[model samples]
Target chain A: MESSRYANPYQTGFLLGLLLVATIYVTGRGLGASGVFKSVVTTTVEAVAPEHAANQPFYQAVVSKHPGASPLKAWLVFEAIGLVIGAFISGLVSHRLTFKTECPPHVPTKVRWIAALFGGACFGIGAMLARGCTSGAALSGMAVLSVGGITTMIAIFGSAYLVAYPFRRLWIGGKQS
Target chain B: MMGPFVPDIITDQLNLIVGFLTGLGFGFLLEQAGFSSSRKLTGLFYGTDFTVLRVFFTAGITAVFGVIILTSLGLLDRNVIYVNPTFLYPAIVGGAIMGVGFVVGGFCPGTAFCGSAIGKIDAMFFVLGGLLGVFLFAEVFPSISDFYRSGAYGDLTLDQWLHINPGLIALGFTVIAVAAFIITARIEKSVNPDAPVYSFPTKSHAAFAVAAIALGVVVSVIPDRQTRLLERATSVAYQQQHPVERIDPQDLALRILDRDNDIQLIDVRPDAKPGDRLPDALTIAVEDMFGKGWEHELAATKKKIFYADDTKPAIEAATLARILGYRNIAVLDGGLSKFKAEVLEVPAPDHPLSFEEQMVYDFRLASAEKIKKLIAEGGKKVVKKRKIKKVQGGCGL
Candidate 1:
């Protein structure tokens, strides 16, 4: 069987760009993902620790910003749902759907899983601080030439490059690929 | 209909639908570009692949060009579009932290969603970890909240900061993007000699590069719709060609006394004092002619009489209205100054007046008193300024 191939980078990028343009033109806002995580965190807190959530300034700010609605009923939340569906469809068509852990040959699956979790945790905290993840602040912000967005973009990639050497083992094992 | 129809033409509910559809496209494109794979995404850091750079730069530049073109063509309103607010320290610090996250996690939030959907177990764990991180942040929110909002700069753009035309910035970005693409492709080859070489078709790639640059040039050459129209409206030649119809103060006074519902008075003066406004007149700035709310007033069947301190501004406003496709628009001849002198403060003739002239002068004297009383009464009934709706947007909760 022929292996599934990725689409050309430039072609995919152009399509993504057009989609963003359409999004901005129609809704007057850009695409976002981290906001979904924010919604989830806020809603969970409101549900589990209603008293604490009410008392907390952070929760109060969020609640006041979006009054008279469930946090889950946000625009980003709906977009995230659609994102999952779209990715699932793409995976199905490409025959790349498999329940497997991807790690370098020398790296153990347990180690990779731990690393992934730690990384995800770090991303979650960082996105909250940054006001956006890559898609939201960086890409969307760049299209609009937003100063904050561009600043974050530079910091994320620049820092990633600076730190990549130290975290080399996680991807390439003991011997560099 | 202009773009960004949300909350006006496109209801909030429909806007959500638009969001979902766009998100679907976003996910599909990301997955197709191999962003669903951690190794492929992380490869940019390792120098094994530059797919992320290529795709990201291309996409960003494309959208920038698209926005500029749309705005230049008058299909979109730049004013209402949301530009992300800048917080200097938060942006830099948060970005640095996100960078660390990217290196450790192997996927940003967006790619993580796409990655997990493809049944990647590591991605699922990442998602769970992300949730924990956010929860932890919320728990410790009070401590960090101040830092988060420390460097608040509202809706600032790079062009504004640099104090350059947006077109020049766009052009510079295009040049930089194209250069990065070429250089990155070369770096990718040197890093892994045995890796599959992605051939760039010379003709098509060059053509696209040229086209992108051409768009930048086009944007730089053509001013935005508002500026272009304003320039044309104010030009001596254009004004001469498009002479606005004018109504005398006597006619306007008579209409005001009669309370003519068919005529709508529009005060375009920037510094119009209280009680200076004509009765039933709505105040709309000349710049605000392009905004959304005044469409009904401008397009109404009732005649619109634009007035300012002098005839120049009123003529300019009427010409702008005409240019924007409004009809039955006329300037108040000699403006409010003329009206105040002729109608409100009519002077008695020194010489004996002809019978017809005396009768007209007597009519003006009586009408002036009635008009003053009507204006005084109209002042008590406040005319609310039309609010132009601003669309709310950001990544925050």
Candidate 2:
């Protein structure tokens, strides 16, 4: 049996805040995650059609600047790698390392998996447009009191709550599948 | 001075050392908070758990206060700190899209890493989907790049744009955050009483609020770095209007003639030589002055007189020094040649000088001749240049 225990929310948040202070103080930048999505995609494109990857408008602007650097050689990429390792260790220690889909009783496994994929794809693309994802834009921005951070936070949550009502059945539903 | 000794003190490997360590802390804390569980994260949308709101707000305000306090204490220079730049249209449009993704996918990028680590197949698909979306974005970027880069507002903060005290703004945040924490907690309890109600050890929300207000007061008292947060163009404009104070040639000559006990002349010329400098003048290349923190040696100085071979180098180097937060950077008018003619004597030359070294010798030799002429003329004159001035922006988020 997996014993589910987590730190109190406020305490965890307090500690997380200290960590953010240390991060910004030391690195002069905040934690980021979605940049890895762009890195991976660039790596794949570069592998298949190097010319196309280099010639793409986005690629020409960014990837070409760092002449000899590998696509994967990014701070966000490395930090993300460490993050997965850290998370895995936590799950393993807590005895929560099970391969399963987490969903409401009425949501079928197929629907959950599909939703995760489709939703993830949207996040991947949207993160780029905003110049960051939730971690980079919302959380980190709030720490430093950046306007972009504040605005993005409002938009993300406000839009989510706006749509949560119409999609109620997808989450809280009638019967177990 | 106390800490945040990042690129300043430690420059060689900033990201590798600090990035992984900070990331480890971030990942560990997130997992311990149960963000590894998709259901727990999705609970933010449902009223079953408002932990995300509580945690997010608390964390954000804490950092804001922490930075302010550290800065007030002189531990960190806030100017060197990174503020994510603001772009209007994309931030809103992209954020809304991400919100939709959040409701549908149950995890954002950082959480997805943890989710996948916990062996969730759905998390893995989410990662794959993210890759596909980013790839698709890159492919279609030629058309969308305009929209993506549109409405470029430079790095902005409430305090900077509104000209309000950061401390006051921070306290306002405290009021809102405390209210949010209380309200969200109530919403959670009413929505699901069975959800774990946390009782933090020792400290209460009221105490935190008081602490926040106190910190805000402290922040408001510290004098701001004027124009420090402005966009590059604006900052440069401010700098232009407020050029570093200068000491004229005649006034400087009178001071040197008296040999004022406190006057310290520094030569920052790249090719300066032994014969080309005044007595007791320090030799420090412009790069070394800023990069090695040698400029900090003059931190307590009342006046710092620096000189280069030409007015251009002197002006450029001094301007850079000013930008790096040095003070009283007065250039020696017309450098060594002026000093030689104003105060020193000429020596008779036996041979003609042509090589770079020879030219320097000739110039020094010629300076003595000019001094005799100046003595005969009995006056000092100033040099002036025609000015052509102009204007800049950047962002990650």
Candidate 3:
């Protein structure tokens, strides 16, 4: 059966444009996805494994200041939370909120989830080491034309391209249509 | 100096409520746009999906253009908004590492939050890993603290650093965004000529193109090229031109001792109830001071005129000084609070209000709070909050 879910990309893009405008108007900043994720990780590790979190420079930064407040209480965290609710709401409205997993044609659902977890963990570590992620760096950076931002965007896209070849079998079937 | 048109007069609880409300809007948009899926996020790397690229570019262009347009109309002062400081090394290094993280994680921090919010279990682990990374950075800060703090450029903006008008820079970016969009569209078509049609609501593409060109032209024309060095130079010139006429308080004190001249020592804060006046000092409200024209009272008189208020009173006194052209204008450093704390037996509970005094209080409180928070974080936090509170009473204030 044909999937009953589809969105007009142009409308979505326009809506996102409005959302971004609102974000800048209210916060005097851009929307960021990675930074908030790092905050969550720091807050959780600090709670569940205080010693390990304390020992790391990254965890010490956020957790130390907001010792009393929840790590999830960050602006980015709230924004991220909103993102999920928004996306899910859209999904439900469109009847696209499925539990089925996505993977390469030959990969098992379990394997795809495992790879996602591994990749996600690495991304978390990398995002912390760097100050921002794609949304913060590539998108926001390009907006202001910060040389660093542009350079980072280049590095990111370039690196991804270089690495995509090896990862093709995982995402798309290797040597197959 | 970037944002929040409305001040945060409300308490922290209220602030969080606003944050949550805004987050709801942010989260809702991400989900609607299909960022919850890792495959879609990673699609930018692959050839199949360009949704992320299109949405991201469009949003950025809209905001950049909005700021430029608003500033041009005098609705917003660009100077009051905050711009991210460029730390040459840390920013570059941090950004590179993050890029690697993006492909690996298939979800940046913001997307991860959205994914986790929608019950993506792997996104949760990504969040956990990010926290671990932050912890690690903090623990190892001492080893690399020097590098992080070494780039001590205090709040430099592109306009200041580039010695160009921000409007021009904005125009350049707009042109680039449009160019990129066109190129991407062409590439998408060549790769898949029968691409799924998702056109915008414009009546004609030509109208959109003309609008984009008009915006680009307007942004390239802002007048002042605001630069840090130039601002500093202007201030130095101002100070040089108007050397502060210093009047020794001791000289005025000795003049008061004469007691021969009929001098009306006005206590500025007359609304100040009993026990309000500083010991051996007079008090007068600004209205009373100017009521009968202190200008007329002290006109062509040889008698000494003395005015004392809190630390802030000096500003008011300056105005009165200019009006009366008082031979001497003296302001207490500690104000009433300091006087009560340092010298007075019974200190005044109500603090004196002056424009300068308010600024001083604001600057001190904001600085003190920031320093305390920074110390508590032990130097790992990236974003710094600066909230300066000033005492305001008059319509001017």
What CA RMSD would candidate 3 show? Answer: 14.6
Per-residue error for B237 in candidate 3, Å, reads 25
lDDT of 1 by residue, B341-371 (tens): 9899978798999999999889989999998
Q: How many residue pairs clash in model 1?
A: 0
Model 3 C-alpha lDDT per residue in residues B34-135, reported as the tens digit of each score: 677677777666665666766666666666667666554434444434344445566556655665566666766667666766667666666666655654
Q: Report lDDT (CA) for all predictions.
A: 0.84, 0.71, 0.54
Interface RMSD of 3: 6.1
Which is better, 1 or 3, measured by DockQ?
A: 1
The alpha-carbon lDDT assigned to residue A91 of candidate 2 equals 83
lDDT of 2 at B391: 6
Residue range A1-177, candidate 3, lDDT tens digits: 233434545456566666655555555455666666556556667778888875776566666556588766666656665666776776666565555455556866666665666565555444444345666655555544445455556666677767776676666654664
What is the lDDT for B64 in model 1? Answer: 89
* Model 1 alpha-carbon drift over 4 Å, by segment: A1-3, B194-202, B293-296, B349-362, B377-384
Candidate 2 lDDT (Cα, 0 to 1) = 0.71
The stretch of ten residues in a row with the least summed lDDT in candidate 2 chain A is A168-177
